[model samples]
Target: MVVLTKRELEQIALPAVQLAAPPLALVPEVDLSAVEASDAARSAAARAVAKACEDHGFFKVTGHGVPAPLLARLDAAAAAFFALPQRDKDKAAAGAGGGSPPFGYASKRIGDNGDLGWVEYLLLGVTAAGAAAAPVALSEGAESSCFRDVLDEHIAAVRRMTCTVLELMAQGLGLDDEGVFSRLVLDRDSDSLLRVNHYPARPEAAGEPAEVRRRLTGFGEHTDPQIISVLRSNDAAGLEMSLRDGTWVSVPSDTRSFFVNVGDALQVLTNGRFRSVRHRVVVSSARPRVSVIFFGGPPPRQRLAPLPGLVDREGGRRRYRDFTWREYKTSAYRTKLADNRLCYFETTATS
Candidate 1:
């Protein structure tokens, strides 16, 4: 919310001279079009996904079948909603109940420490039954009745693509049950969250040197707690990932493609064969950026552990202990966003 004026936006805009060049050779791109093609083609695509998951836990996806017009419409709607005043945006707030899930507009200050990110977001929950249980209402000032319709269509399309991707990943891992991954995520009670993020330009800090101010981050480093996350963003680059070597690589913003990242749950299911990506968003002085992310997880009551098949194949060693989605999520929410939530669930042998 908090409709920012042109002058206010400009005040936070980073100067072009301070912008860093995009990093190279970070994450590879996988073509989803090959997923349903000939066996050889599908296998090749699966191999690419496997490699990306094992090495970086992140990859870009093209030919995902999401219409360009639909993506544009979703972006336009989000921009319009975020441009409204704070009071107007709060009409659909997550509500005052202490037990409410984090499912609506979350402003800058979040976490126990009141850490501030230069971003604001609207979170909507979707179930396997169909679209969001409570569909997001378009702000009246948005002046477009079609906004909600387009958004719903977009969410539906992405969910289909998410399931397909999971199937491919399962095949890539040599799983006999092709639907194992898909079933875990598409269950009727699964909590699939769609987050629409708006990262405004960084404001100039008085009396601080330009170099020092440029070091501020929009969001601190962290890994997702779900099975996977699919993200689409505008051309303003800010996302970065931590490599195994401890180097941080910037991910170029490519609006036409979706970036997929493995999450903690997937890592456990794969018996640590796959990795969970640790990444962060850096604030830019250029222009404000917008991104839409879909995070998929298992049903709240579903017990999660390294697959028995994977464990038996790997000398019967379990990397993580069995835990329910409810337990994992509770632990995740109780700590700072940047903390490594997976550490809390590691098997005692590994610990």
Candidate 2:
């Protein structure tokens, strides 16, 4: 966590804009059970996932096969870890040192570029080998050992669920191969990461509208740069996602289910067929919000561009230039969290 001085705090505070409330209807949802059922059932589910991706670029997921007790254990473990003193928590992720943009613990600050938030997070890299080895500081103690165990189980289950969702996405897109999307994420060198975020409770005081004009941003709006992201959060209502129309809507939190959103890579791969949702979190009430998100990215060396199948078919034209995940990732790291990192890669023509 980056410590803030008085001058820094002023810069970190921003007014939360009050946007229009979305329709009463919640985001569309997909159930994973059908994928394991009859062929007809699978088709129906696949169409639903496809439609949600094309229309909203986001959806809620159910029947994901992860046990509620397991998630509860995860929450308990996370809470225990965060409740520790700052010094102890710092020692936990101190292994790789900071500013790698790869993994470890962070608080208040979002990235190296000074984007601050009312959030603290633990980010761990996972590959074919296993969940990231528990940091040395965390593994030394009995309690931390249990945290590591719960963390391992949680990552294993989430990874499987995420891959299944990706497969369904392929089916929905009418792709000939279901594994096309899933295989990249499962590669031995995949840069997939799991982030456990805790938003501390900050009660909003009732006061003159002018006095409350400024709101603390729990997290600023930004699009996930990976192919997809799977997110689960406790029953805290701090999440807000932007709609196609540019209006922001509050996403009601449900601890039992997960939320899925498209990322920039998917947008490019689909040649603009799907959109990457921009989202943020705000500290609204006295309750705190804890969210766990898994970002599934391809290997750093994997080249990214609109799939030839999409571009060459139906007179489609390439909208983006080819680049490796490493190139894009490096570019994204240099910018602010809210910058449209994809814009630079877009192709344009002159008469």
Clash counts for the predictions, in order: 1, 0
TM-score of each: 0.88, 0.91
Which stretches of candidate 1 lie above 4 Å from their native place?
Answer: 1-22, 94-99, 141-144, 204-213, 348-351
Where does candidate 2 have its weakest 10-residue lDDT segment? 16-25
Q: What C-alpha RMSD separates each model from the true structure?
A: 4.5, 2.9
Clashing residue pairs, backbone N/CA/C < 3 A, model 1: 14-285
lDDT of 2: 0.81
Q: Which digits, one per residue and each the tens of the lDDT, describe model 2 over residues 72-134?
A: 998998888788788877765666223254467778888888798888888887757557544
Q: After superposing candidate 2, which stretches have Cα over 4 Å from the reference?
A: 1-10, 19-25, 96-102, 133-136, 203-214, 349-351
The alpha-carbon deviation from the true structure for residue 41 of candidate 1, after best TM-score superposition, in angstroms, is 0.3
What's the CA error at residue 303 for candidate 2, in Å? 0.6
For model 2, which pairs clash?
none
CA lDDT of each candidate?
0.78, 0.81
